[model samples]
Structures are given as C-alpha cells and as structure tokens.
Target: MHQLEADALTSPRAPSFIVTLYGDIVAPRGGVLWIGTLIECCAAHGLSEGLVRTAVSRLVSSGRLEGERIGRKSYYRLTDMAEEEFEAAARVLYAPPPQPTGWLVTLSEAETVSTDWLPIGPKAFIAPRRNDVLRPNAAVLSCDTVAGIGALRDFAAQAWPLAEVGAKYDAFLSVFEPILAHVWEAGAPPGPEALALRLQLVHAYRHAALVDPRLPEAALPEGWPGGRARALFVRGYLALTHAADQHIGLTFHDSRGRLATATAATELREDRLRRECLA
Candidate 1:
C-alpha cells in the first residue's frame, strides 16, 4: 500500500474512519456519542490523542457534528442533516442496487465538445450518476429520462464508461483477494487488528462502489469484475463481524447498544427499499 493508503487504513484521522464511526457506530445508536468515546475508538485504530480530538472539533465547526458539554466533559452527536445524509448513504452502501429504470439526464449542443461523459464524436451527454454535462456558456436541455429509448445498447455504450468501472472493480479485487483469503478462521475471532483492518477494507471497497454508477450486470462490459468484488466484500465483512463486534465490546463501554440499534435502523431502511423501490 502507498503511504497515504497505509495511513488511512491505520489512522483514525482519515475521513473513512470518521465515516465508519458515525455510520457503523453512532448513527445506529441514536446519533449521540461522547467525545471521549470517539477518542477511545480512534485510539483503538492507533491514532494519537491530539489528532482525534482535532478531528472532532473540525467536524463540529463544519456543521457535520454538534458538540455538547456537561460539567467539563464533552459529548458529540451528528447534526440532523448529517444523520439524514449518512442514513441514505448506508442504504446505497449496504443494500443491493436498483437497476436503472429511468435515467436523469442533461444535454448540450455545441460547435465543440468537452471530453468527459461525451458520446463518440461528442454531441451531448446522457448525464450519468457521477458525471454531468456542464458547459461554460451553452443552451442546455435536461430531463428525468426518456423511458425505453430504442437501440439502448448502442446508446448505453456511448453514454457510460462501463470499461472504466470494470477496471476499478478489477483493482479492488487484486488488492484485497490475498487479505480476504483467510478472513474467517476456524476458532476464536481475531483481535483489535481485525476490526481496524475490516473497517479499512469496507471503506476502500465502498469508495470503489460509490464512484461506480452500478449499471445492470447484463449491460456491463464482458468479464465485469464488480460482482466478484461485491461478493468478496460481503463475505469478508461477514467473516469479521464477530471479531469486530468483540472489539467494540471490549474497547468502548459507552458504545453498548449502538450496533443493535444500528441494525434495527438499517432493517427499516432496507425494508422501505424492498417495498417502494425494488418491488
């Protein structure tokens, strides 16, 4: 791993760890957590006292977190907006993706065209999930979607960068395959290292998935790697679940009930998706 990546995996100062702490721990347990609890959690990730303390202050000033003090002790909680944001993100991160039924898009016309997300020869953009058509000074047309466009295959090929997404999946697989090989051992769960490693692993894979629009398996390029990657992620996470939970129990006394609460909240989110969106 690069120095940056190695540090990210080990350090609680990383945004990824903060996200993990908020999403996996705090959000589930009702958005309120002690500053000391957060510091201790970060310490378990091998971060120093000052760095974690600074991170909490930064998050508070940025309005993503709110801090409260009682008798010289500090408590922190997710701001309402941040809690809502992370709740939505967790659904996308954990649940199966919905196939793109109707695309939301914007189009532009020009004498010359820009590079990103442009069809071959570059006329307009279909405005994929990540990329959009933003011209400097041009008339633009936008729509929810043109339902069931004909010759969809050719159009999809022109609009989205499926090959690039495939390559990202491949990269994720290559990096984690060796690490996941024995993630699930026969007997007792591994210790704190396993918890840190698993969180880092989830964060890395989640980053890859977020960048991807996650097109249907059928529409993807030949030999797409996303399926294998998701499978590995789920399987690897399951393997570490027990160990990670143990770490949580051992390290943070205040964190009790957070995981169970988070699981219930997650089920509610997933249930809504099953009824309203997936169905």
Candidate 2:
C-alpha cells in the first residue's frame, strides 16, 4: 500500500520476495497476511504453491518469519529479525533522492583492508559506511576529512566506474520516462493501472538505486541523469497515490473506510536515501 510492489516484494529471491511481501503488505499497518491470500497474490505473479511452501519453510527455519495457525486458517508475519531487517532496508529502499554531501577521503597507504570500513585509494576500496575512516600510517600528510574538489570526476570514474552504474541510471530513465509521460497525460486521480505502474516504477527504481553509487552530481560525468530519474519517479508516484489507494481498498475488501483514510498515502514516501555505493 505504501508504493511498494508485491511482485518485487523481495530483492529477486524467494526469501527476498517474502521479505517484500512482508514489508509491502504486512508491515505497513503491522498486520498479517493469510496463507491463502499470499498464495493467491503470488500466483498472480506465476509463483507456484510448491515454491511458496518451500519459501515459507525456509523463512521459518531461518527465523525471518513466523507462521501462526488460527483455528482452521494459517497466516504469516514478520519476525523480529525480519522486522529489523525491513526497517533498515526500508530506510534505504524508500530514501529520498541522492544528495551526496561530498566526503573527504584521505588515502593513506595500508597493508590490509580488514577494517570495518572498506579501503579505497591505492590498495584500498571505498568506505562501506558513510562515517567510516581508515587507520592512518601517520607517515603520510595529515588527511583532510572532506573530499577535495580537484579531479573529483576522475576519482568518481576510478572508484564507482561510470560504465555499469551509469548504464543502470540510463536504463531506469529509459523505462520510467514513458511512464511519467503517461501519468502527465492521465492527469490526477488514481486508477488501477496507475497503481500497478507506480508499484512497477518503485520496483525498477529500487534495483537501479541498488546499482548506482549515487555520487554527488558535481563528481559524476557530465550530463548525469539521476536528477531526471528522481524527478520522474517523484512525479509518476505522486500522481498514482489515488490509484494505489484504490488498489488497497479493493485488495483488502474494505473499500469505503480505506478510501476515506487513504488520504495519508501521499506523504512523499521514499527509500534508499544514502549514496551508499559512493560512500
């Protein structure tokens, strides 16, 4: 209901798909989805019942989900671990567009990259976390905590590599541009098609977000298209909230009450905020 895709409910695996189902449908209002409902929904996407049964068994064995038996019915919901994982993932998955506040990385020669942060520069890799820093050799010049403006384009090129990640953005824009255009044409007021498209857009954009390094606009190659992609995503999703709400109502079987309260669905929801790949 919160601009997530049921088909994309996970990150391209059975477990991830289950995670997506939990996060997208179950976690929103902190409720459970019945086994039958889940099976039916998954079937709509061509997931066989046997696969669903296997995935559920695997998830329960790993403690990511808990199955509950209520009288003659069965249901499933997120376990604490899944809830925590989804919470962390939701922050990144629904993050606002990239706004890389330039990082100042000081490259000191290191013998090993075993530290919590990834080593970059020379033998090191980029820092894994935004706040991570390397232990200094002390023999080198004092490091600057902020990224230097000089040759940032080159730094980005060497570090993040424009070819693959840049292609990801290009692919995202290619798919979404037409969808956004259609949203403009259809105007406001949501419909089933809009909701379906919005979920699809979120799913596709999430994949791109995972692939992109999310470098600062200044550091990226000339004619960077992330801004365009973000703008298009924002436009397409906002216009489709009506459609998403329409969907939730129909899916949940309580059409009027949901429609009345669905007003809150348009709160500029976002995920995957960090330029994590760059950091």
Candidate 1, residues 160-191: lDDT per residue as tens digits? 76666677778778767766664444332465
Q: Give the distance in Å from residue 244's predicted Cα in candidate 1 to where it truly belongs.
A: 2.0
lDDT (Cα) of model 2: 0.56
Q: Residue 169 CA error for candidate 1 (Å)?
A: 3.2
- Residues 1-279 of candidate 2 have per-residue lDDT tens digits of 223233223323455565565655456545456777666655644577888889988988998878887767777777888888766555555553346554434354555433433345575444422332344443322232255555767876776756776677788787667556645775643454555455556666665665565655667788877767766666666666656656655664211122231432123342222233223
- Using all chains and alpha carbons, the TM-scores for the candidates as numbered come to 0.66, 0.66
Residue 34 Cα positional deviation in candidate 1, in Å, after optimal superposition: 2.0
lDDT for 165 (candidate 2): 65
